[model samples]
Target: MSRKTFIKGTLILTLAGVLTKIFGFGCRIFLSRSIGAAGMGLYQLIMPVTAVCYAIGIAGPEVCVSRFCAAYAASRDHLRARHTAVFCFGMSMILCIICTVLSYMGADIIAGYIFHNPHVAPLIRISVFSVPFACIHCLVCAYYISKERTVIPAVSQIFEQAVRLGAIYIIVHIAHNKGEEITAAVGVAGLVCGEIAAALLCAAIVLTGRRKNIRTTRHPGIEVKQIIKTSIPVSLNRLALHGMQSLEAALIPLMLTVYGYSAQHSVAIFGILTGMAMPVILFPSTLTGSVAQMLLPSVAKEQSSSDKLIKSSRMALVFSLAFGFICIIGYTTAGAVIMAYVFDEPKLSGYIRIMAWLCPFIFINTTYKSMLHALGQAGRVLLNSMLSELITIICIVFLIPRMGIYAYLLGLLASQAANSALSICAFTRTVSRITTHKPLRS
Candidate 1:
């Protein structure tokens, strides 16, 4: 968790993220061509549900594991760090298993009622199986991240994306050869395959690595009470945020319909925005995302040192904003060409360019929230995030019907701007308190 180590971890994860994005773009291209925009839209509808499930099962536990593991490892308490990983892994696995069962059983209900589209039920059923594997992958990655050992996590990330695109290509080819229609369900199947592959790889590494390291005697241990106390609030905050996000996502196409587009056209437009344009705009965030992720463990480790924490936070914020502005310039100039040529969706160029304005806010928010979480400000993160989502929802409900998709874009930009401002204010206030008083303990 030294500054050098933090930079090294960020570089490793950034490289991995870039490779993953490459493979992911390939997968997306194939899916968009094979199943079309409406199909991608149908597939995107289920993503929020999976995200909610991830929040419920893994998000809180991952944060807790990273924070606690970093603290324990810094104290040279390897035994406790190992135990924390195991405990969180077990807890997350059970929760994910329950989510899998419920999602599978209730896929029809969710698609028909929540999404108001029965066609996505099959995708839902297929996609839910990825949750347990994803939980496993993330928890293992969290542990390694805490140890500042990015090699395993980085490798697993690339391996997963490679396997996913490969699986999708093969499955879609087989289906085409068999004279069967290709659909978004194939895309969901590929996702599950990728997760399974990544989880197995991580599990293998952890098992082999632990053989010589685990000790027989117990030392001062991390208690279940401590884990719950840290994880539950974080979990609830994430659950609420993700729940609101899910609602926002679901309401988009529905609101678009109210804007005068036919059902099919509305869904297709939704697909283009979420699946195509959004990805292109967010492509540069891999660097910021990597920095933010590495910052979490480092920040957690340095939480007792006000000077170091403040310095790191300031550096992250500045880097993210500077990089984001550069992205805005690149996207404003070349984004249209990328979208038009890459996806063969010339219509997406406008969306991409328009959404380019979100880069600074999005990038800054990424780093700020990570540092906030590291500082045990999950409640602030939750509140700021909720306010953003609420703004988007309000716009979707009232404005989309009048101004069309442009209104939604405006809402997104405004919301991210608002969230970024709020996050900065919170960080400033918290760190000012630290500077004036004492460093806060996570």
Candidate 2:
């Protein structure tokens, strides 16, 4: 976790991320053209279930495994680190299994009752199968990240995206040949295939790789307890955040309807914003996201050194600010052109420009949250996130009906700004206390 190693890992991850995003954009553009906005809306509607599943089964364990495994490996306790991964994997698998069962069983109710769109039931059924595989993919990646082995995870990412793009293309091509109408389920099927591919690759590497020397007969009872203890708060935080996001997703179209648009039109608009404009706006986050990925484990490993933590935090903050503003300028200049011509969605141009302001705050918030997680401030993170989502939710509920989509954009800006301010204030206070040799408070 030296500075040089951190930089190298960041570069590797950033490269991998760029490739992945490129592949992903290919799939996205294909889907948009093939299925159109309404179809993409159906696909986006079910994302809440996917996100909730991940929050339940992957997010918390992934963080705990990365943080604790890196900590153990720093102490040269490879056995403990291995045990942490195994235990977390087991817990995550159980949760994922439950999630899959519930989702599959209740797909009809979930789509018809919750989302008010029964057309998404098939997509939900197809999407649920990917959760367990995604859990496996995330935990394995977390383990590799803890050991500072970015190559395997980076490779897995590219492999997954390639498989996804290929699978989607093949499925759509076959359907077209058969004169069948394209649906969101085709996209969901591709997602499932990609997760399965990545999971199998990661599992194979871990099984065949040389960790034999670290094998032990000792039970991991204490480690399991520690993992659970650390994971619960993080898990709840993720679950809450995803839950709010799900609520927002479900409510957006409904709120838009209240704003005088037809149901179909509202859903189509939702699709354009989420699937088209937001992607272009958030594309540059690949770099910040990679840095955050590497920063969390590095910060965890160096938490004992206040100076190093502060330095790392500063570096991440500065980079995010500079990179985010650069992206703002780039998007302001080219975003409209990209959206209008590339996606063939002329309507998205204004939305992209408006959403471009989200870049700096979004990137900075990501880095600060990673630092907070390394500081074991999960509760504070949860509080800030809840407040952030609450603002968006309020706007969606109250303002969207009166002001239309512009209200939602305003909410996004306001909420993210609030969350960023809160996270920076808390992160600064926590780090400054460490510099003062005082106990850190959540």
Clash pairs detected, candidate 1:
none
> For model 2, how does the per-residue alpha-carbon lDDT over 1-442 read when each residue is reduced to its tens digit?
8878888888999899999999988988999999899888888888889989999898889999899999988989887788788889999999999999999999999888888888888899999999999998999999999999999989999999999999999999999999999988888999999999999999999888856555657864436666777788788889999899988989999999999999999999999998888877777888898899998899887777888887887887788789988888888887677766888888888888889899999998999898898888888999999999999999999999999999999999999999999999888888888788888655
Every model's TM-score: 0.97, 0.97
Native-referenced Cα lDDT, model 2: 0.89
Q: Candidate 2: list runs displaced more than 4 Å.
A: 210-222
The lowest-lDDT stretch of 10 consecutive residues in candidate 2 is: 213-222
lDDT of 1 by residue, 81-165 (tens): 8888899999999999999999999999988888889898898999999999999899999999998999899999999999999
Error of 1 at 248 (Å): 1.4
**Which regions of candidate 1 are displaced past 4 Å?**
438-442
Residue 395 local lDDT, model 2: 97
> What TM-score does prediction 1 earn?
0.97
**Model 2 pairs in collision:** none
